[model samples]
Target: MARKVIESVTCDACSKKGLEVPGTVNLTVMGDRYDLCDEHGARFRDQLAAALAPAVDAALSA
Candidate 1:
């Protein structure tokens, strides 16, 4: 049995296209989950970190 994906979003970091397919990072918010590719997932995480707080920007180099 396989779990169905809820939604698919493009990688905000890389322009690569992705689908709501399996084998990807999943994040559930408000009873909904978004599927992101590996590269984009990292980017999404970074964006989320930055959005959550300001410390993320200070941790960046240059």
Candidate 2:
């Protein structure tokens, strides 16, 4: 078996970065494969959610 590599991406929220621990997700979000570290993931998710809400709402409305 091949060893799995955990890819890390810079946090989208604070931009205060950390090493990305490995995990699984249904789809990659905001160009990152997994959530950011505790310092920024929450803020990143919130910002992403807010930024995407209008688009999502429009899609849903349509």
Q: Would you list the C-alpha lDDT of every candidate in the order shown?
A: 0.61, 0.57
Model 2: lDDT of residue 62: 100
lDDT of 1 by residue, 1-62 (tens): 99998764553323334333343666667997766668667777887877966665566743
List per-candidate RMSD values in Å: 8.2, 6.3
Q: What residue runs in model 1 are displaced by over 4 Å at the alpha carbon?
A: 1-23, 55-62
Off by over 4 Å in 2: 1-35
Residue pairs with backbone atoms closer than 3 Å in model 1 (clashes): none
Candidate 2, residues 24-58, lDDT tens digits: the string is 22236578564445545555668889999999999
Q: Residue 8 in model 1: shift from native, Å?
A: 13
Q: Which candidate is the best by lDDT?
A: 1
Candidate 1 TM-score, C-alpha based: 0.47
lDDT of 2 at 13: 32
Least well predicted 10-residue stretch by lDDT in candidate 1: 11-20
